[model samples]
Target: MNSEQRKFEIWRHKMVARQIVARGITDPGVIAAMETVPRHLFVSEALTDSAYGDFPLPIGEAQTISQPYIIAEMTQALELTGDERVLEIGTGSGYQAAVLAEIVFRVYTIERNNILFLRTRKLFDALKYHNIVARYSDGTLGWKEEAPFDAILVTAGGTQIPQPLLDQLAVGGRLVMPVGGLCSQELVRIEKKADKITTDNLGGCRFVKLIGEHGWKE
Candidate 1:
């Protein structure tokens, strides 16, 4: 690789080591996916230098691409085995979907913001991420046509986990999201078993509002 590519490679490795692994994210597939995706290409040219930093960056329309650790943590929580269909809410910069695509059989992602939807779709196409299927719609409603997903990930924070998403999750599936007040939320993971559903709080986090029919008002 050239100088710029080499620099980014080094930074990516360091990010995985210090930010992700150091924080106790131990999933091998998640680590590989996080290291493989080119996060810099998902941000504006002005923000490329900071793409690998341990923080979020604006991607326009009052949205932000989640930090690397958050992405890794959420993806790891899904416990993907590479043969499952995944649904992702809030495509944003498409970085999170790309990370999922790297480790899953396929990823169906939805975005409500039209501008972000179009931009991220083009980016996915240009990057040749064919395993990712993106749609422009209210993510909180979930994708019913593609229901019974093996795993679901909602990147935005909502007042509560949307009922539609829980309904669409396949039996024995896992859904990870942030739910709570407007400014902050508790990262929660919902597992749908045949007999009963279980919810676990992963931690506290902050994300842009999840606006839709079942979420925050627009």
Candidate 2:
């Protein structure tokens, strides 16, 4: 690799070993995806050098790209098996969706911000992340026509788990999201079984509010 590529690789290696693996994010797929995807491409050039740091960074449109550890945590909780079709809300910088695209068969991502949506779409194409199909809409509504996804990931924090999302989950599918008040939130995962849904709090997290018909009003 060239000098620039080598620099990113070193940072990514340290990031995985310390911020991810040491923190107990042991999913091989999650680790692999995080390693392979060039996160610097997702953030502004000014913040590119700090892309692999242990914190979230602004990506414009008042949204932030989640910290690497949080991304790995949420992705691990989904437990993708490579054959699954995943739905992702809040495409943001499209980094998370690219990570998922590396592990799953297909990924349907939604972003409400028009600029971010268009920008991320081009970035995904240039990166050859063809498995990621993006849409611009109210993410809380989920994708109705694409219901029954094998896994669903909501990248933004909402007051509650949007009912429409729950309704779209396939039986035996898993959904991971952050839910709580305006300033802070807790990471939560929901599993849909034969006749019941199980919920768990992965831990605490913070994200921009999810605004839409079923989410916080604009």
Candidate 3:
């Protein structure tokens, strides 16, 4: 088998199947995508050994690669069908975007941190994941030019769902985000249907602050 395949097998056993999936991820597609992606590539060289570990790790610039379970859970929550255009609000490490790319038609990810934007762009290019479009910008504005997204995912914490992002959601589109201050937050799922919107609280989570216009105060 090729090295990539071997790495995938190791990831399946060591990360997804043995750790995340077994721990109740329940989404087979998410598990498969997590298994196949080489997560180590997204992390810094110093953290390579713990790449497959079931925990978050710092990825520089006061950001971190979300824990593997969180990634799987959030991706699965979107209920993707491999045909929707997904907008990811934070592209830290590009790990989440990579996972979404494997399951969606295309991904447009925005990172407010310039360093992270450049680094993630290079990583996506090197991995030949052409479907992901990475940009350095304020994620809370929801990339208005590319509105009507099939799905929108905010990876950072904010005080509330940004109105612009809500406006950008396509009719029947789903938006998943963490809302609250730095010390506490709730993971919320919002579904838009025409002019009506329904929201559900998924659970609690802690994420870096999303700083930008329409996001947290500077």
After best superposition, candidate 1 residue 145: deviation in angstroms? 1.0
What tens digits encode model 3's per-residue C-alpha lDDT throughout 1-218?
99866865676568887777777887777877897788988998888878888789999998999998889878988989889999999899999999999889999999988999999999999999999998888888888888789999999999989999999999999999999988989999999997689998989999998888888876
The model with the greater lDDT, 1 or 2, is 2
Runs in model 3 with CA error above 4 Å?
1-8
Query: How far is 194's C-alpha from truth in model 2 (Å)?
Result: 1.6
CA lDDT of each candidate? 0.94, 0.95, 0.89
TM-score of 1: 0.99
Clashes of each: 0, 0, 0
Task: Assess every candidate by TM-score.
Answer: 0.99, 0.99, 0.94
lDDT by residue for model 1 (1-218), tens: 99999999999999999999999999999999988999999999999999999999998898999989999999999999999999999999999999999999999999998999999999999999999999999898899998989999999888888999999999999999999999899999999999999999999999989999999898
Model 2 agreement with the true structure over 1-218: per-residue lDDT tens digits: 89999999999989999999999998999999999999999999999999999999999989999999999999999999999999999999999999999999999999999999999999999999999999999999999998889999999889899999999999999999999999999999999999899999898988899999999999
Stretches of model 2 off by over 4 angstroms after superposition: none
Score residue 38 of candidate 2 by CA lDDT.
Answer: 96
Ranking by lDDT: 2, 1, 3
Candidate 2, poorest ten consecutive residues by summed lDDT: 201-210
The pairs that clash in candidate 3 are none
